[model samples]
Target: MNRITLVRRGFVALALVSLVSLALVACGDDDDDDGDSNGGDHSTGSATIGDIAIEGAYARESVTDVAAVYMTIKNSGAADTLLSVSADVGSEAQLHEVVDSSMRQMEGGIPIPENGEVTLKTGGLHVMILGIEGGLKAD
Candidate 1:
């Protein structure tokens, strides 16, 4: 019934929502065919948007108002950039990277090389969700 407990519960709820969103976006067929015959070995938990493929998207638990999301992006065409990330559970979302063990917001976005891939994981690049609604309850 204290303020701190309520805040922690809100963070937990928000993290769960973010995780579900990532899972939904990354869910797809394992048949290497992302609606195309390219036969590029696209595995399970991968979804294609245009020439961009997203795989294994997930989020970490939150004890505060911020949460982090991780994933792998594969580019099958011209190079592209990841400008930003959004989640309904928070008021702000940003692309972040860790430098010298410190976290900072990424400027100019993340680049995906042509025919290459980028992995966003802990201690590296990831998405940060902030200002999560405090009304959320764990129950």
Candidate 2:
């Protein structure tokens, strides 16, 4: 298989593992709200990957099989492109753009200009998570 196909298969396997693990952990009361009961913070983190600084990463509580992740990607060095995104909880992850009230998948990836930042937010460019495992839980 080609590189893209291999990546997609990896994502599918990850999603399947996530689903099974989530199911195993879905037992017990889910009404606790101490912000730490879910074993990890659901909507907050920061990380620096090479010259790219990613911050404010979070996903809304998903009630369905789909969800989105919002964050700020800043490139401090040479220009780069966001080719693809993979997640452990989704079978497919895609970059999308919202235009004129319609959302569409982004092809060839999104460009990250040098010394610039891209904000992925609602009604804007964002990462769409397809086939989310057990949906996202609110924390």
Q: Pairing residues by index, what is the TM-score of model 2?
A: 0.68
Q: Give stretches of model 1 more than 4 Å off.
A: 1-18, 21-45, 134-139
Each prediction's Cα lDDT score?
Answer: 0.54, 0.56
Q: Write the per-residue lDDT of candidate 1 for residues 1-139, one digit (tens) a residue.
A: 1111001111221122224433222222223111111111212234555667677765533445666666788779777777656666667777888888778899977888889999987678887777765522222
The TM-score values for the models, in the order shown, are 0.65, 0.68
On TM-score, the candidate that comes out on top is 2
C-alpha RMSD values across all candidates: 14.0, 9.2
Writing each residue's lDDT as its tens digit, candidate 2 over 39-123 gives 3334444556567776676655555577666678787977777767776666887888888867888888778788999897767
